[model samples]
Target: MWKADIIESPPGTSYRSVMEEYGYEVGKVIGNGSYGTVYEAYFTKQKVMVAVKIISKKKASDEYLNKFLPREIQVMKVLRHKYLINFYQAIETTTRVYIILELAQGGDILEWIQRYGACSEAQAGKWFSQLTLGIAYLHSKGIVHRDLKLENLLLDKRENVKISDFGFAKMVPSNHSLRSNSPYRQVNCFTHLSQTYCGSFAYACPEILLGLPYNPFLSDTWSMGVILYTLMVAHLPFDDTNLKKLLRETQREVTFPSSITIPQECKNLILHMLRQATKRATILDVVKDPWVIKFQSEQPTHEIRLLEAMCQIPFSATSNRHQSLDYHI
Candidate 1:
């Protein structure tokens, strides 16, 4: 049994020393955020390279420390999918919270687009299909990844898509269900709506931009539309420089570039996702789209079965734990 080790390092001890005690040799920093830095490390027990996000308790806000941080950990603990970054473990200390995760060596999708400039339609289709599968799995579990953008989509060594960053993710209220009996039909599953206007401005939906209570799942699909659009053009569909313009642009039709030739099927899918929130395409709808079906390798049934099996495994059985602490920044 992997026990989650939530311990406090002794006075004067460094994070590297604490990680070393847990069989991880911390290496160079790979990524950075407002309150944390992600380090590339080697886990001796597993003999594999991993990414460790070290968040400083002192720098994080009270809301983050008391609410979002715990929720992020809780959500990551249960998520298991090929297209999602695998959560290894979390070790919290007095000063820092260390989250060990699967390392996506190929870097984020944004970097790839920056380097290669827009992907070919076939390549974008593959990545989009993989992303849809991952999102479907999350929606099936009733979890909404409120943040979905090109920067959050990472790639492994094989260039396979791996969805990362769960800081803004939230589980739907217990009363509302997100699952549907048919994979092709859009079910009115969410009676309750999310008011939290979270995620990048360019990827945010019109409902969120207008401060309306929006369906979280549908908002996620809106971000997917942005991602797919970005994947094809190597740039965001809408410019987010001004709030009013952004709102106007989202409400209106999304214009495509004449420089690149995009297939009608692909354009149609993007339009469906970027349409009105009430009439937007759900994740299931994306999965069933002709372009997605052309690249999707696993059937929707396989994803459902995988999610069901993962749900059966208790969190305690998979992670180690020490004493819990109440923290406020």
Candidate 2:
């Protein structure tokens, strides 16, 4: 039997507190993130399982505990999307904060990839299209998810991808598209998204590494490119232990190994996304791309056999270059 963690609840405070007051039943720890521990909990009235992420106020800086966390909560409450994980409820006590999220029982894409090398193009196409759609939702709402990585992409039982974790997300303020919006203008994750960059090093854009103000919208596109490359090749396109060298490599041309055979249309899209050009492929380019649209119109297939098939093979040359993935400047 699993014992639930006890948390004191004050009357009429928030959704979480009210739930806690009613003897909220919690299950075993299910996941972990940079800021908190996630657990499975039951909503007695609703009788549905949910993932509860608890963040301790003690570990965070005063500024973050008071300012940033509140902002994140506010933005998340208003911003809802199909492909993004649903934020159900939040409650802040004197010592800690509890966040209720949809449970992705299928686990995260990182675990999926580690166990299974890569998904077949069909699976990849479905997942990739969904990913871009979710991201597009964030951008449309003037929110920039700064920390986008395979680890943050959660999967439900249906193999559908959910973009989670807005801990480091910025809110921009604009109805204009990212392409038309002036990057030089003040950006918020909800409003204008920042010129200052802070995200996981491995997935960060070059402008972030260069120590210059960056375009938060474009930053996401770069990470998407890295993700697209990984989906097609089962490995990172550019990786170097030396951050300096890695940045340089990313600024240059990207190449594929001779081992894998990817169609030119897919390759062209990947290359277009990975380019360091002033004008890179936008969300429209990605969605309207011949390959993506094809998958969208086709019958749904949740076949992610890429990992299961390669489980027996000993794939080499993979490293977690993100060991020091802390935010840069």
Candidate 3:
């Protein structure tokens, strides 16, 4: 609910000044990853909750700024879709860069699954539509989210999904080849073709696994399909403690148990998504699936309205405290 426009960043001010201006009190560490650590913060000026990602300056190597950090910021800046996380303003100083962002109190989809087991088809379908809509919007903007997994998908208190973390994101120019050894360049014309394997190996598609230049957007669809399957079964389709065995299982087509009776529409969608590149479903094809139609018809009456409230209303200007209730406690 932070008012983005009024969030000030002044020249020569330190990181502490930036947080203090917005009345942000640093709290317990909520999460941490390679890029930085995130802290739960209370914005006193706005009387609202927010997540402040405090990026350690020491971690800001040349490779990180050129390839990872810039791309992450660019992707988030351009993506204004409903199912995507909202980025407030970034405050940079000699020692840190504090990224103020919307806080999803309900945590991520992974936690939900672990706590409640697999979701019913009706539940999975409801969430899937919102997810794909965001993905489609990203594709339209020519940005590819290389990593798409349950852990990266957060659900607000209202059960609305928000896609987060763009560390591995890529923005392909209009004329850039989807499959090529082109160098990734940022400011100052630095460039390098990626040789190291990237993204979560379990969710990675065949092209990435084979070390070929793959279309990140297309690979995401396959990962989404896997997530959909996990939501239905309460577990991953393929599982092996050994890394080699796990990769081999993922390389082959996913298989379900005999007793599980997934809906035909859901089955069709999964099959289309799991197909090899030459036969997989296109973005358009996914939107046209029958399961998607049925899924839309079944959304809880409250979900859409709550999400609209979150998107359109900023907590800073409002006198009401109920806005926070839109997220789960």
Candidate 4:
């Protein structure tokens, strides 16, 4: 329903008048990004505050408006899990586009991690489980969240992790193989679906950094590892003052702080998740991990049990490189 009537008709309506008509009161600007500015607004009827993302149509390219933005809205509309951001509406005017989204009162994970330096394993464990479920849900839907950084992981008032920002998400059907008949079929999966590599450097996977096409699922899992490490230790697992050095380091093993008191299981989980593309953990592997299970507060529900069983099939990491890479939106 939201997708069918995304673009508002009778363009050029003042934003204030539009809000009043919808029984909403616009408030302060809370965030900004390349696509738009996000404002905090009150829904008078619902008595809830929502994030209103406003995108300027004129400043965007044809492909961005017709392809990227529309695709983003479509993805958000389809995903309805608790760990993911909830979408209410998409309104496009002649001058701009407005996306009504859930507002996370706890703010982004980045700020919280920065403030606390490092969270206890008990605390991090809860967040990790939620984060993993969110990513797993995306993968199950055949959607590859190309970008997953601390900033994209938002927290609600209760500190529940809600994975957000689908600007680079690409859908690849699980059973629909692109290379079924090609000689290099298994060599590449996301080659045709997504041509460019994009993500924050610190958390990006080896395959993406090496200028090669990647399996979006595994790459997302790798980012989860980086996220876990950061949450446990307060800093990036592979941080460096030099970009070249950092890139070189990601190819090798990750280093942990000696002074920190990390559990053996936590360390092992990070090791497996942050391994080379060929040896890294799959989504199911993360869920089935003994450490993850040990730290998790309770048994997963029937749905999670089904996912764990369903994803138990074997999966290896994608091929990677050390060459310079190129990227696009």
TM-score of candidate 2 to 2 decimals: 0.79
Candidate 2, residue 15: the lDDT equals 42
Q: How far in Å is the alpha carbon of 255 misplaced in model 1?
A: 1.1
Stretches off by above 4 angstroms in model 4 are 1-7, 174-193, 297-329
209-271 per-residue lDDT for model 4 (tens digits): 766766676788889999999998999987657776767777777878898998988889998
Model 3 lDDT per residue over 56-158, tens place:
7678677876678766776676667678888876766666778888888889999999999878887888788878777766655556677889999998889
Model 2 off-target regions past 4 Å?
A: 1-19, 175-193, 297-329
True-structure lDDT of candidate 3: 0.67
Cα lDDT tens digits for candidate 2, 1-329: 12222345563465455556755677889987656789888877678888888886767788777777777777777766668888777766666778777888889888888889977899888888888877766665556788888988999999999998887776665433332444322222222225555777778877678765555766788888888888878887877568988887877778988888887888888888876534556554565578887777442222112111211122221122122222333
Mind giving the per-residue lDDT tens digits that candidate 1 earns over 1-329?
A: 24443555565568989899889999999999989999999999989999999999899998998999889988988898999998888887788888989999999999989999999999999999999999988887778899999989999999999999999999876531233343422223233377877998999988788887777878899999999999998899998999988888888889999999999999999999998865678776787788899998878885455334323334453222101111111
Clashing pairs in 3: 1-315, 157-327, 157-328
Which residue pairs in model 4 clash with each other? none
Better of 3 and 4 by TM-score: 4
In order of listing, the candidates' clash counts read 8, 19, 3, 0
Residue 33 of model 2 has an lDDT of: 62
TM-score between candidate 4 and the true structure:
0.85
User: CA shift at 218, candidate 2, in angstroms?
Assistant: 0.8
Cα error, candidate 4, residue 71 (Å): 1.3
